[model samples]
Target: MTYFFPKVRQAQQHGWKGQGNKAGGWQEMSRVGAGARLFEATAVGIALLCLGARLEASELRKSPVVRAVERASPAVVNVSTEQEMQRRPGMFPGFRGDSLFEEFFRDFLSPFPRGQARTSLGSGVIVDPKGMVLTNEHVVQGASSIKVTLSDQREYQARLVGADPPSDLAVLLIETKEKLPVIPMGRSNDLMIGETVIAIGNPFGLSHTVTTGVISALNRSIRTESRVYKDFIQTDAAINPGNSGGPLLNIDGELIGINTAIYQKAQGVGFAIPIDRAKRIMRELIEHGEVHPAWIGVEVQSMDEALARSFGLQGRKGVLVTQVAQGGPAQRAGLRKGDLILSVGSSKITSRQEFLEALSAYTGGSQISLGVVRDGREMEVKLKAESLSTQEAVRMAERQLGFTVDAVNQASKKERRAYSMSGVVVRSVEPQSLSYRVGIREGDLIRQINDKEIRSLEDYQTAMARALRRESVTLLVQRGSYGYYLTLELGGGG
Candidate 1:
């Protein structure tokens, strides 16, 4: 076969043709057979190359990260909002006939100019087929108009269904005749650290951007200047300004958390609200348009050096129970005054603030376990929370303060004339009560409870209900021409 191919190539190069001679006919026949064999060999090589290339591409496309992004992206949305900016006038009084001067000083005096609109961009995930989108509350806060752009480039007007500022979660509704794609919800309570996670959002106004990272930590707490946020899902994924309210998905393409950019100084550190906590708040928002405060009827105070020593804490951290409401969840669960609460569920309680933060994750009827140290013995007590009511709040306040109050308008003519203010007036005081021992007297006008202003009877009730969650409340009391700020310990009274 080799000898014939060489002879055939040499004969064809020399212009040999099969005209009439037998040698010419043999050369032509050999050349024809060799040419057909060479063409078939080349075709086989080309097919092998194509098959190898296809196999490599198929593996890359089947990657877990790639598949997760593909499954979740369709439910992700770009949220843009428009808000009217309010202008502040100059501090000085208005002057006439000084148009030029006013114009010159406008830039220096006024905080902002009128008739300007502010626009913001963020991300959202569709959690329901009915077009209910979930995002951060700050994304749509004070928004005059909101617009949502789906991954398919379909735009629709969105209206706020409900917003919970404390949880930083909001729900938006977009009415469309067709059903929208939704992301499957996953539990955050069992999320493992260092697990792969994906973040999809509209960072810097770019829509449907995807980033990948692992869960950095769980049950993390982040503090800002104004307030502290707890129970966050910390991740290494890049969460920028517009990434707020985006979905944080696990490797299985399930929604585990809602990404948040509250900590602005983060370099590789990003935080999110755990889906387990968000789920309770979302249900409340969808049903009642707000998250109601849950009460367990126990007042806790921060442990001080003296109190810590008295309770034999040594160096342990916990809050001291100052009071437990009668016939309430805490009382029914065997919780008592002077008991030190070491923890709430799995979270250790060091201060009153931390205790409140832990309890905020739950709603009414939630059964929670409390770790307590009673008489130097450690024990766990379980209690169920109840929705706070005005009647219960008033009863608690009366028993704790040992004082009964009436609205200022319902006071006697002489008392009203003497105390002309918008607050609640003490109608009677228990002689042997803590309030009485602290120099609180009848006819005292209560102007504020903790940080809440008391302008009406409803305001007073609401303030007392919130104060019930704390171990002590500071009251701003006005008596005669003098005013005083008194910190009163709640619970035990005459």
Candidate 2:
């Protein structure tokens, strides 16, 4: 990568004396050649330019990452992993299922080879003095031979302590007689946009390379090969292919982020896992070897000003429960379809992410109180949260049109101020549920059944009993404030 400079041209006719110079009496000219003068000037200019570039390059080489790597390289270790993978010549194309090339290539080219040792390399941080290390999960995804290289050039076999792929964070442990230098963890929340950050990692097998840049953005969502990391701290830090699992530190020498991914097509944009989220996952992994999150089994949506006004909500706050899964904890506790969830226990949940964060903070089987608004009535419901089987959860998520009703009562109207209605409102029909398949919901409001006009719970029961008697029945339904008609529907299928 050499850069060429433009060739300087010499001025002609240097033999003739200039009028400005002292008059020469046609004597042997003392005047220097223009070409020589141009050559000398060009040499001096080139030397000055070289000196300036050297100074600039020197300054860039001494930047923050360069400085941090010098100080923290001792704690950063290289990891080599070996894993075992399935090998079958028939499983691949251009294979006879019996060739040595196929068999050997399958084993040789894999990150995890069959029966033989497969090697991978990445960097790690020895965060604990007791020899606990932090690295990316991808580094040890299926490793069989894990090695750690210290700054002193000593290599030691390491073992996986725990790993969480959702956060792309992993922990390793090794035995040593002496304590290793640890990087101090810092609060990533204190980071501001444009604040300088340093990335220290082993890039392209080049150990202890440092790159520096200011925080490009905060709370970024990044998609990587490992996981979809949300709330990442984006920076201009020069992270390359082999920089995974390295630390992104603040100026005060504290680990703020974990260098994880970079935008391949773009320049100066990189992302790191925020230290706070990583620490939470690490604690769970190191302590329990698995993370157990509380499951409420309800679909919630954020309440915006428009939705709040439409729902006639008091203060445009709290997460709105859009749909409660059948047989879930909320459903078992009598939580209905159109309830506005005010809070879970003492903490107020404002968004879906906040709800998930709050829920993940709690252990499974914890009983919590839920504040909700039903038909404009504020009530407290005690929900004993339980983790449901995957199959059961999937089943519950599908029964959306099993029931239909309208917001008719005063309390229901006040709670659903957005609808601007006084009664239970029938919004939409779920396709696969019993009601929609039998022609229900969308505009049908229960006016009455079997000669009785349905107005409340008692009236609804009476109408339902009569309608159930007929395989297909008709019910008096109100389409608007004044219009009413008979809506026939089939029963006994759910």
Candidate 3:
């Protein structure tokens, strides 16, 4: 390539040099003169070739992106999961990809029922030398089996420690006798926008793919489920579907955040969970098998001009308290309806999302000084953080199938009847839950267990008891609009 450009120049400027003596430019009487000219041309070509080679080598070293990738690439691993997916006739299996499809592809709504295995791939950072890996909770949520492949080509079966769905984080433990590479975490709070960062991930099943880009923005919010808010570090780095749970590193090769969500349809738009926010959540998950987000028992909305005028507030800023739970922390702190929450501790509250985000910074039982405006007067109120309440069905499911479900009541049944189904509604499926391995889903209906029809909670309990004793319990499940049969083994082998 280096010689091609000079060759083109030589052809343009020295086209007459290649002509015979008949051409006037090379009119030489002796062969010795022509030989001298050839030698001079060869020397100049050599010098130009050497200079180009040196320039290419010099520019390659100027980039630290390669070195940064080498520094953190070893700690990155590929996370692969296998789940049994059962599809019934005339039902929507749901869109589980990272794209914003709103619904699954319309073409997948088949008329024939089918059951098959599903495989999902993502990336993870080995934060612990003992083989404790951190990944996005959605990657292994409904997986029947989990596997982690290291950079050295060694694969290990991973065990789920805990899952925090609201945060989209999960911890996994894998037994390894050999020394494991660990990724050291840096402070995300110290990160500056426009600083160059590297993203190491497995995008589209390609392992250890490195992408470099500057931090485009910070404190970005992406709303997935209603009431669940996510603050992400926006970067121009190419983060694809399989890059979830990977590491976003600084030039010094320190992890600043974990890559979680991305705008699939758009280029140069990716989001990562800050390392600081993930650290506490990781500790809580590994210790308690659940995340206990601090709760104040007050529902709030972003303050608007209309609400501020109605409440007779000063500035139309901060969060507006809509409802306060009786006997809760807000009530105990003297915070009431129509009051505006100005701040939490030292952080200013601008919107309901910001208020919730500030509250997450506190753990259970921590005393926090809150700033609120009432009757156009500002005052400070103190309250202690408490663990958020768990639904009764979730508690029961945790004891039974290691998941959460709601009772199939008249109201719920009416909705289910659209699919010609009946039974409980699955709210959340815990990682490695018993029902998960058998291809059960959040929208699936549990109609019968071991040949016992279950239309109500009492019937479900009775059926569960009998199903627990059988070697392999068969259940008639109505998943969306299609009813199908699923068999679960007694020992969670289904």
How does each model score on lDDT? 0.84, 0.66, 0.74
Candidate 1's C-alpha runs over 4 A off are 1-52, 90-111, 304-316, 375-377, 394-405, 408-415, 418-455, 463-494
What is candidate 2's TM-score against the reference? 0.53
Per-residue lDDT over 1-494 for candidate 2, one digit per residue giving the tens place of the 0 to 100 score: 22322222121145334444436422223233454566678888999999999999998788655565666667778777877655533455665665786657766765545565666678888888988888888888888778888878888888888876556788988767677888877887578999888888888889877788899887665655422455678888888766888888888668887787444554667788878767766766678674444456676666788887888886747777777766778788988765787777654767655454345434346677888887677899998776444333323322422555554656655543323342235545677766666565565565555455656644554345323322334555555455454445332111
- What TM-score, to 2 decimals, does candidate 1 have? 0.77
Q: Compute the lDDT of residue 269 as modeled in candidate 2.
A: 78
Candidate structures ordered by TM-score, highest first: 1, 3, 2
Tell me how many residue pairs clash in candidate 1.
0
Candidate 3, run of 10 with poorest lDDT? 98-107
lDDT of 1 by residue, 1-494 (tens): 13245656776677766555778668667677878688778788889889989998998778898888888899999999999888665454566347775676666665555576889999999999999999999999999999999999999999999997767999999978687999988988788898999999999998988998999888898888645788998999999999999999999889999999988999998899989888888887888787666778887778888888887877767888887778889999999998988988778889888888788777776778999998888999998888878778888788778998888774452764446558888888999998999988888888999777898788899888767655578999888878899999765210
In model 2, state the lDDT of residue 57: 91
lDDT score at residue 421, model 1, on the 0-100 scale: 56
Candidate achieving the largest TM-score? 1
TM-score of each: 0.77, 0.53, 0.59
Worst 10 residues of 2 by lDDT: 3-12
Candidate 3 lDDT at 319 equals: 84
Backbone atom clashes (below 3 Å) for every candidate: 0, 18, 0
